[model samples]
Target: MKKTIITISREFGSGGREIGKKLAEQLNVPFYDKELIEIAAKESGLDKELFEEEDSRTSKGFRLLGALGYSLGGPLSTITELSLNDRLFLVQSQVIEQVAKEGACVIVGRCADYVLKDYDTVLNVFIHGNMKEKKERAIHSYEVDERDIENSIHKIDKRRANYYEYYTDRKWGRAENYDISLNSSTFGIDGCVEIIKEVAVNKSL
Candidate 1:
């Protein structure tokens, strides 16, 4: 395929990652998800645990900032005094750009869509699902605790949204921010993969 990059932004429990992985397999390209963290850690010579910790703390960090009466300026507002999260974001973005420059890859999360916004051959997709179905999927597919499944789903989604918005200055899951916004509940995982693959292939051709 001629499409060099595909970035997927997804709601919690939406199977967006799965769709991305399957599409990459079909298109014969590299896939990056948690792998981005690994790549960033290695390339930046930072502890992998640091990246993982900051990666998971985006929402809590935002809340802490709010509690401290901080503004919601973008992550790079203070270049000289960067937080660990900011540092990780910078390294991660570098890795993303390097990989995109090298060749085709499917990237999930990490605000890759915004990072590669200038790429002419990139397709950015957002995946969402009905609340009821998402809860069910979380419990069964993702093995989330049933007792707090609903709360967990919302919390994770909030975390993702905060992370994307904080770094990219764009609203996460917003249709205008993505080339394609799909409903997993409407199209299912395989269907979503096929549709995205078709679009990517046609764009490449």
Candidate 2:
């Protein structure tokens, strides 16, 4: 198969991560969700907890040029020099670029669409579901408290939106920014995966 990169942005309870994993398996490529954190940690020599803490959170400091550069591998790369948020962002951005450069892979979240914006074979996707369905999915799949599910969903999605916009200068969940925006509510997770697979394959060919 032709090399292609798929990036999935999702609402907290949307099951978009599952679709990305299945799509990657169908396409015979590595899937990067949690694995991305490991890669960044290994390459950057940062604590894994740093990645989890800054996961999808906006950078606390402004250094657009620094974030764009990836060759910060030396003694100066210490956490004391760079903010943890900026360091993780740069390292993960580098890791994302490295993976896409290698070949086809499905990356879920982490502003991946914006990270690979210049790549020719990348397919950017956004997945979402209605509040009612998402809340139910959280309750059934994640066993989130029924009483707290709605607030939890809103809080998570707001963070995602803020992170995306802060880094990419693009609105989260906006259809125009992505190659395709899918509603898991309209099409089930399997259905969404099939459609994404079809689109990714066709584009690769």
Candidate 3:
């Protein structure tokens, strides 16, 4: 059987991360969330904080090479030419591809969906929820400060959208970009996981 990779793009406070972890446990595969940042930092010898900062904010310039998964392919002296955000993105994307190549796994965020776009055995999923449901999850589950919680959610989602669009040239959360889009509000976290789990398992057949 061939290995399968699952990449999840989620709205903030939608419990999408939790669903991804649960699905990985059910399938007995590796799960990557913020772990990707740590791995990239360690592998690239860059500070972990750099990856954290670049993970959300949109890049200002120096996009083309990184978006295309270019690695400079030249002397180490060439690395200095790229912007900080572009450098970090290229490193993190390399980490994403390496892990996917290792085996079946679930990777959350950091544009793993776009980075692994060419993989034949990959399943891309986007998870979203209504404002009411997402707000509740944000406050109660994620503990996103109750004060101005709605604004906080909006900011996070927008950052993710901008970052994704800037690199992928595709609209984030659009149905056409993913193999499956799930409404966590309607199906609930476990339900969504079960749905993805079934599809992933079937793909390995």
* Strongest candidate by lDDT: 3
Question: Model 2: runs farther than 4 Å from truth?
Answer: 1-3, 43-82, 203-205
How well does candidate 1 match the true structure, expressed as C-alpha RMSD?
7.0
Task: Report how far residue 45 has shifted in candidate 2, in Å.
Answer: 4.5
Better of 1 and 3 by TM-score: 1
Q: Model 3 — TM-score against the truth? A: 0.80
Could you tell me which residue pairs clash in candidate 2? Answer: none
Q: For residues 46-127, could you state the per-residue lDDT of candidate 3 as single tens digits?
A: 4453444442334322343545654444533355455566656766776787888888999999888888989988999999
- Using Cα atoms with residue i matched to residue i, what is each candidate's TM-score against the true structure? 0.81, 0.79, 0.80
Q: Which of candidates 2 and 3 reaches a greater lDDT?
A: 3
> What lDDT does each candidate get?
0.77, 0.77, 0.79
**Tens digits of per-residue lDDT for model 2 on 1-205?**
4337899999988999989989988888989985765566586554453444442333332233245633333432343445565555766776787888888899998888888888878988899999988998899888888887799899989998987776666789889999888999999999999888888777554
Question: Candidate 3, after superposition: displacement of residue 65 in Å?
Answer: 2.2
The TM-score that candidate 2 achieves is 0.79
Ranking by lDDT: 3, 1, 2
Let me know the TM-score candidate 1 reaches against the reference structure: 0.81
